[model samples]
Target: MEQKVFAFLMFSGQADEAMKLYVSAFEDAGIVSAKYYPQSEPGAKPKVLHAIFSIKGQQVMCIDNQLSDSHPHAFTPALSLFVNCDSEAEINEVFAKLAEDGKVLMPLSPSPVSTLFGWLEDKYGVSWQLNLPAR
Candidate 1:
């Protein structure tokens, strides 16, 4: 058996949409595999049961949580996916894309730790931290 750990995001009903957006936002990112919920019940909306995707060589899993309403907890900035960008331009571009229809926690600007850094929550409420390491 393969024992591995990865970030698993639970979405209400937007797992597939979020996966597509992520694949488009980052280079070398794509969905590896996805399984959909069986349409056993009438009027049941198809949703992602499980999915594995890669972003910049990092694997992340996502699912459409059936119990999302029961679990009121949500993704928070306290635990954000941090991306270390190679260039200021890359960081800026990524920040712009992520900020679309989203709330910016921190504007992309020069910081003491990095030449450029920003924090934002995507439309799906997933928090991200984009940073360009200080030279």
Candidate 2:
């Protein structure tokens, strides 16, 4: 038997926003399901409890982490969502959208392995690698 695996992202009450951005940015993408936290106290803001969304058919799970400021863990560039673009135009468009208000680790340019390749961390601190594979 084979086990299914998917990327899970923890957000500081930004999971909903991130999911909306991702689904809008990628084609054939949408939220599959979402669960929100019930307001437990007066004037408490409801947060995303869990959400499963798909980007071009790849499913990713996200949740809001209501942790204290002293929490040591955070999203890092070490793990990234690698996108294999079908064309230069697609890569450029997606890259630009993702780079908005985000840090670009490597500018999109031709490389030995790909005609267009770049790395960036989005506003939500999620790293992504865009690449146009060799024809």
Best by TM-score: 2
Q: Which stretches of candidate 2 lie over 4 Å from their true place?
A: 1-3, 39-46, 68-72
List lDDT for all candidates, in order: 0.87, 0.88
RMSD in Å for all candidates: 2.6, 2.3
**Compared with the true structure, what per-residue lDDT tens digits does model 2 show for residues 1-135?**
332899999888778888898888877789999999887888765578999998877889998887725573578999999989888888898899999999999999999999889999999899999999888
Q: List the residue pairs that clash in candidate 1.
A: none
- After superposition, which runs of candidate 1 have C-alpha atoms over 4 Å from their true positions? 1-3, 39-46
TM-score of 2: 0.89
lDDT of model number 1: 0.87
* Residue 8 lDDT, candidate 1, scale 0-100: 90
Worst window of 10 by summed lDDT in candidate 1:
1-10
